[model samples]
Target: MSGGENSSRLIDVVLDESIGRSTPDVEHERAVAIFDLIEENAFHPVGDEGGGPYRLNLSLADSRLVLKVTREDGGDVVTHILSLTPFRRIVKDYFLICESYYQAIRSATPSQIEAIDMGRRGLHNEGSQTLMDRLSGKIEVDFDTARRLFTLVCVLHWRG
Candidate 1:
């Protein structure tokens, strides 16, 4: 990719293990989201002219989501702490729908699985939008990047 492309993307993402551990399924989701995020994303901290492919460390503290951004060389950029209140409902619903979808994969018909999957994706999208809105003026990210970040957020929230 070009220099500009590299400057606005994430090169690495780390989830704070102290927050919690994930189940196998959740682990898979976290891994995939991180992979996808690093592969391509638009992440530019507002007013940051560091021109860097950033590193992100996600963690939860006191029911709040903490986003720590740093330059590729580990220089501090910015950290955003956001309330989890707005995402509680959507994350809960998304978890329910995801469970249904996973269960459906074992026995339900393709149509049924597709329907559940649709709801799961819808919730995911809603959560992504909420994240983008919450990060407004703090961090700028495209919709797809927001989606992946939302997935990571959900992973951090997962207790099992």
Candidate 2:
């Protein structure tokens, strides 16, 4: 497929309710990430499926990240389950940096805040790259899509 072929992308995304409770901030973050993801993303599932506007459900079950992908009308496409072990360290670091970034916003100088935010973005990129690596052959997603999906994964890790 060519670059301008209207690559498959998500039409709707749902996170399982069993993922556990979330604070308002976490919820807001999730909302923004999902909104951004669906607004503009590149998600092309492997195999011939005539391209798609897919629906994805993300959840955690038995310590594994469960990704359930389907067509817009609910036809099953693929289910990808990935272990959480690989993401543990990066997610932990991401959360810690996020906390610091939030704090830095309160009293730190502009430069300090910018530096912390840069570190946060760096870690975020690392996490997203890890996700893309893990998702290889399962589904294809662009960097920005991976980044947004990484945020959702980190949100799930919050309860793990």
Candidate 3:
């Protein structure tokens, strides 16, 4: 469970209680992100916290993103509070592009949709990279894992 295996990944992930209602697509995106993240990810907490199989709870509070991690058995691990200020611009751009992508899918030509999707993926990658940079020294995760986590963060910010 130590070296390089999926054993160090998150076993469960939950959103805050007040997430309220979301569009079907939004809910689907959240579900897939969590499922894919837990299924295959490399997440190793820094310091003497010990290796995981961890559970993560994501929430937004007062313009901050709260990541509460716990052991598989529910023991406390670490709570990382990150100010959302740095992510504001990127998230906004991502959402706006995503909306365009979705709309393009409905009526635009194939090439148009593809172009919008490419832009969407680029923004998504940028957001993921920012997340990795922000989480550096606090938690370790691979690029794909960070991308999925970024999706969850966007979902959490949907109402804001």
Candidate 4:
């Protein structure tokens, strides 16, 4: 791929297995988010000289979020370490809403299910915006990309 085409997107994404295994629901969400993110996203590491089509590895260490980026050929690019403190409450609340949404899908009326989903989506968007704000000068990503990344971040926070 040409540098321009490759420079602004991620070709691969991985979550650290050390974090903990996820439930089936979380696994499904992780798969879909990675697929959607790779299919289309705007991810450009600011001040990167190698250009992109980057490979991103998401992990948590020392209670912080680590975003390790690399070139398509596995060359080193940049690693961003962000605090998890800002995400704790959002992630907690998001999981709660997600649980409600999942439960609603099984027994609640369509309207109830929709209402719960709306709340879940709102939280997701909020998380996305927070991520974007945090990455302001490090990694530039569009809102859609941020949303998918937020899902992956939640996957990292998944304890079960």
Where does candidate 4 stray beyond 4 Å? 1-3, 23-25
Off by over 4 Å in 2: 1-4
The best-first sequence of candidates by TM-score reads: 1, 2, 4, 3
lDDT per residue for candidate 4 within 1-160, as digits (tens), equals 5557757899999877756677897788778878988988999999987787899988878999889999989999999999988999999999999889989988999999989999999999999999999999999999999998898888767655
By TM-score, the better pick of 1 and 2 is 1
lDDT of 2 by residue, 11-92 (tens): 8999888677688877877788889888888998888466677899988898898999988789988898999888999999
After superposition, the stretches of candidate 3 with alpha carbons farther than 4 Å from their true spots are 1-4, 23-25
Would you list the C-alpha lDDT of every candidate in the order shown? 0.88, 0.86, 0.84, 0.89
TM-score to true structure, per model = 0.92, 0.90, 0.88, 0.89
- lDDT per residue for candidate 1 within 72-119, as digits (tens), equals 899999999999999999999988888798799999999999888888
Model 3: colliding residue pairs = none
What is the C-alpha local distance difference test score of candidate 3?
0.84
- Candidate with the greatest TM-score versus the true structure: 1
**lDDT tens per residue, model 3, 43-83:** 87777346678999887788888899998889898999988
Ranking by lDDT: 4, 1, 2, 3
